[model samples]
Structures are given as C-alpha cells and as structure tokens.
Target: MNILCVCGNGIGTSVLLKVNVESVAADLGVDVNVTTSDAGSAKGTANMNDLVLTSAELAPELEGT
Candidate 1:
C-alpha cells in the first residue's frame, strides 16, 4: 500500500506519523510505502498514493481519492 502522511509543514508531524505507520505495518505484516508532504503540496503529489493521513480539516480534500 502507498500511504501519504501530510501535515502543514511536512517535516515534523508527517515524519513522525510515517515512522509510526511503518512500525504498525510491520507488526501487521503488511507491505506499505509511506511518504510525507505538506497539505498544500499533497494534492498534487498524492496521485500515486493509495491512502492519505492528515488532520480532519484536510480529510475532505482527499475524499475523492
């Protein structure tokens, strides 16, 4: 699975979330590729991702994906 973890800055919370997600995916024996991005850039870059992780405010933007 391709997962994109997004935050306002793309360097702090998004990186932390990516690490946690990878750990959980490992524990579950799931193969996943996680990437991080800022909310503004995520929409343009998320086309390759299968799932998106972001704050509630950003969720609706990804709904159509």
Candidate 2:
C-alpha cells in the first residue's frame, strides 16, 4: 500500500506522521510505501497513492484526489 502524508511544508509534521504510520503498519504486519508532500504539490500526486493523510485544514485542497 502506498500512503501519502501531507502538511503545510511537507517536512515537519508530515515527516513525523510518516514515521508513525510506518511504525503502526509494521506492527500490524502491513507493507506500506509512505511518502510526504506539501499541500501545494500533494494534489498532483495524491491520486497516485492508495491513501492520503492530511489535516482537516488541508483536506479540502485534496478533495477528489
């Protein structure tokens, strides 16, 4: 599974979320390829991922993606 974690800058909170997601997925024995993206660029790549994780404030921008 591919997961994309998004944040304002794509380097701070998103990176943290990526690590956590990876840990949780590992615990569950689920294989996932996780990546991070900023709100500005996420829309373009969001659909490529199986799941897109982002804050509510940024959710609207990724709608339909």
Candidate 3:
C-alpha cells in the first residue's frame, strides 16, 4: 500500500507521523510504501497513493480522491 503523511511543511510533523506509521505497519506485518508531503504537494500526489493521512482540518482540502 502507498501511504502519504501530509502536513504543512512536510519536514517535521509529517516525518514524525511517517515513522510512527512505519512502526505500526511493521508490528502488523503490513508492507507499505509510505511518504511524507506538504499540503500543496499532497493534492498533486495523493491520486497515485492508496491512502492520505493528515489532520482533520487539512483533510477537507484533499477531498474528491
């Protein structure tokens, strides 16, 4: 699965969440291709990814996927 962790800058919060997701996926024995992206980039990239992870306030901006 391709997962995207999106945030404002794509360097801090998104990276942190990506690490946590990686840990959980490893524990669950799930192989996932996870990436981190900023808000603006996420809209362009989300279509190619299987899942988009972000805060509730930011999620609406990424709708219609």
Candidate 4:
C-alpha cells in the first residue's frame, strides 16, 4: 500500500505524520510506501497513492484526485 501525507510546507507536520504512520504500519506488519507532499506538488501526484492525509483546509485542494 502507498500513503501520501500532505501539508502546506511538506517539511514539518507531513513528515512527522509520515513517520508516525510508518511506525504504526510496521507494528501492524503492513509494508507500505509513504510519501510527503505540499499542496502544489500533490496536484497531479496524489492519484498515484492509495491514500492521502491532510488537514481539512488542504483536503479540498486534493479533491477529485
């Protein structure tokens, strides 16, 4: 499975969430690839992942992906 964590800056919250998600996935024995992206970068790329995580404000931006 693939996961994409999105945020405005891509260096702080998204990165932290990526680590936490990975840790939890590891504990559950799920091998998944995780990615971190900002709003702009995620536009065309979000559809490639199985899931996307982001704040409510940013969530709409990823709509229809």
Q: Candidate 4: which stretches are off by over 4 Å?
A: none
lDDT of 3 by residue, 1-65 (tens): 99999998889999999999999999999999999999989989999999999999889989986
Model 2 alpha-carbon drift over 4 Å, by segment: none
**Candidate 2 residue pairs in clash (backbone atoms < 3 Å):** none
**Candidate 4's residue-wise lDDT over 1-65, tens digit each?**
99999999888999999999999999999999999998889988999999999999999899999
For all candidates in order, the CA lDDT equals 0.90, 0.97, 0.94, 0.95
* RMSD of candidates 1 onward, in order: 1.4, 0.5, 0.7, 0.6
TM-score for each predicted model, relative to the true structure: 0.87, 0.97, 0.95, 0.96
Best by TM-score: 2
> What C-alpha lDDT, on a 0 to 100 scale, does residue 8 get in candidate 1?
86
Estimate, for each residue in 1-65, the C-alpha lDDT of model 2 and write its tens digit: 99999999999999999999999999999999999999999989999999999999999999988
Residue 54 in model 4: lDDT: 95
Pairing residues by index, what is the TM-score of model 2? 0.97
Off by over 4 Å in 3: none
Q: Candidate 1 — which residues are off by over 4 angstroms?
A: 61-65
Query: How does model 2 fare in lDDT?
Result: 0.97
